[model samples]
Target: MNTLRIQTRDGRRTDISADTLATLTATLRGRLLTEDAPGYDAARRIWNGMIDRKPALIARCLGASDVVAAVNFAREHELLFSIRGAGHNIAGTAVADGGLMIDLIEMQGIRVDPEARRVWVQPGTTWADVDRETQLHGLVVPGGIVSTTGVSGFTLGGGFGWLTRKWGYTVDLLRSVELVTPDGQFLNVTAESHPDLFWALCGGGGNFGVVTGYEFDAKPLGPTVMAGIVFYSFERAVDLLRHFREITGNAPNELACLFAVRTAPAAPFIPEEQHGKLIVGIAMNYAGPLDDAMRYVDQIRNFDAEPIVDLIRPQQFMEHQKFLDAGQPYGRNYYWKSDFFDRIDDELIDVAVDHWAQITSPLSSSLIMHLGGAGQARPLDSTAVGFRNTEFVFNMQSAWDGDAGSEEHIGWARAMFDAVHPYSGGSSYINFQTEDEGDERVRQSYPAEIYERLVEVKDRYDPTNMFCFNKNIQPSAAVLRRQRADTSPVSD
Candidate 1:
């Protein structure tokens, strides 16, 4: 490794030249901390507790130039490199062991253009920041359900939230992205120019490159919207869930809802007795006129079952994002498995009910999001986001105690996913994918033609397979042959 001629933020490597260190320092307006630095340990922390990788250098990138410099430095030495946008990925690819991490946490700039109904954002900024800024102009970007999720990663991996059923995924609204390629070049990619790269980044995860900033088309939204949770007993969960699915599919675009089976928490709204009980709750976000939203949701609210709690009402969209935020805290280990369903059938409902009975941790919850309407209208070729044909996204999460209970929770999730997979559209949301699995799984996530196009784009940008950490698609010569054959058919 001594002959590697590596670059270091500090004096860890004796082979690094003084000139290279000086150039690196000039690139970062902020501090570049090495492994031996005072805050090195704290800076490397990520959302998932299971990931404990330690990077050699944590460059707190001040601007795009810093990112470019970091990429080159890592490439020059052949050292492993990783990009940290929001570091909220459950897969924990943001931080790699003994590699370089280009931390973008300092780049939290957001500018809203109300007249144009668009917003420019830095990768470091979160959904909460976007909402807070855009709400000043009565606008919003369709983002992740959690406000704290980073725009860079969330948008890259296909963001779906309260506004998803209404406005489609976040990538649908992206107008442009400013990114630094793995080869140390800065480019502005969009529909008109470098369209392939732009398409790959949409749902390509972080495989293509590090996106420094994004320009998004914002939509008119609410500072206050009708949203909250409506709880039902476990015994009636199947009936309630079936009805919930139907209502959500037929409901107005403004009305977005997710059904969850979780251990009831000791919140003030729930009765003291119901605390710790297995319960099914329909969480909702209605983005249109409150009266109309209420009218649309009345069918579910008016159900005959005596409800334990009805906390649904008009509140700030920001508040709605924060409602479940407290429940999902940092440090508890998380393992997730997801299935995309074309329709919610009775067989699937039975599987859900069977698993709902065995949920051991209060943090463990299963989520079923309604997908369709505006979701399916987006052209398959518009972005690399997969599972466009599916109408529902289901996640089986198991957040348990220590390593001892790992097998139990994981088994349950796998079993539940397997049982209902027959109804799945042979695809899943890439963001929620835990195991890298294989190329076939990734291919299944997207339509066949779109997957091949993405492979071509990946070959163009990352030919050497440097950014193969995420759901990777290595472009083979065979793929090129087919592409050429398709384009070069008989011209007589």
Candidate 2:
């Protein structure tokens, strides 16, 4: 029966009586965690090892009703709160210091409609979870490359993966979402039902509300497909990169490839001497029929020079989705800088190669993900997703074992990002942004019209700016002024 001191939306601290706290806890079917609670520390630990935050209260939500309770409590108290799904975001915005943390990790639910080729997924469900059920009927939802990524954050922030070239970004597959607004109203939002809200959520990054469930249009792809990676010597990085760009430029919708420059891992497929040495790799997924996929695979296999390791072959689609999982294990310190590219010119390629040679950590890498195909075919105004006409995405990902050498690793990523930014399309992916990138970086993530439109949506649904943690989009000043005026006392 201890009284609690929680942070308010305006950054002031306020005390809540034990009775009040107990009332909220009692209404929840899930548990409410205080600082001294048994699982508080474990619940706060997220995928990134660098973030160490402590929320005043953690509401472990078990279902939509639990989410409703938490949202209502926070709104009534005017408490600052953050939402956590799988806690996999690199920015670590899920847990707010001294504020309420709506932990949705326990709400893992997935219902698939085989006949409709659709899925209704709970916020806590990960790409791996969704894939498991969808693949039961040989259907799939386009999701993030990392299997551990949460469906909620990934979908809200414009998700893409191996199937992106064929199916489009994850948001494109979204049919509807079940949301709990800042004011505690539950809404099942769809394009036809709530056009503005739906557009804002497509790539808006959790700025509007807490989404409990996502309904996605799933497409049939694979029980098995031709996919894997090919490793080459770093000495031929320029030529290999050019080859990768050339082939990908002419690639069909079913073929997607990512070019990476990093040190090789000590896997059995690679030569012992080549392990831990710098190398360039082309990881590919060809989702069409096996017969047609082999033709594209053969072209890479027969490139001018022999590959150091060739692991490309037919594999289960789920296995292909998890190809990068080992490299992105949870609790590892990670820093990322990303942007979209209109084209991979020689200058950008050289800059990336130069930065690759100066890599501070063995776990760090520079990635060039080929874009276009189905994604580009969609109009720029079709959804809130930014930079549709771009040809590729470049990400400078820095991963290290611990907190040691953090400066060196981060500095390297920033330096690389700066060198290659001039070649960028001037917009970046919201999902890849880091915590320190600031509000301007967020504004740059969308087009001028799209950013302004997102703000209008925010003004309408979240005028108080209750959810300001993720790449925040603030409510308009006019709306705020009107709200203040309406709440002011009447004259005598």
* Cα-based lDDT for every prediction: 0.80, 0.90
lDDT of 2 by residue, 1-492 (tens): 599999998889989899999999899999999999999999998999888999999999998888999999998888999999999998999989999999999989999999999899999989999999999999999987789999989999888889989988888999999999888889999999999999999999899889999999999978998999998999999999999988897899999999988888898888999999999989999979999998898877767877998878899999988988888899999999998888889998888899889999999887889888898888887788877778899999999996799999999999999999998878988779898988898899889999999999999999978899888898988988998899899999
Tell me which residue pairs clash in candidate 1: none
Top candidate, metric TM-score: 2
Residues 1-492 of candidate 1 have per-residue lDDT tens digits of: 112233332324435555666667777787777666789888899777767888767889878988888888776766666788877777777887766788998899999999999899998888889999998988989887878778888888778888888888888999999988989899999988987888888887787877889999999988889899889888899889888877876777677888978888898989999998988888888889887887866876877788889888899888898887665666667788888888888888887788778776677888898877677788877788877656788988878656777777777887777777887777766677675456677777787787888778877887666676566677667755676687685978
Clash number by candidate, in order: 0, 0
| RMSD of candidates 1 onward, in order | 5.5, 1.4
TM-score of each: 0.91, 0.98
lDDT of 2 at 444: 92
Clashes of 2: 0
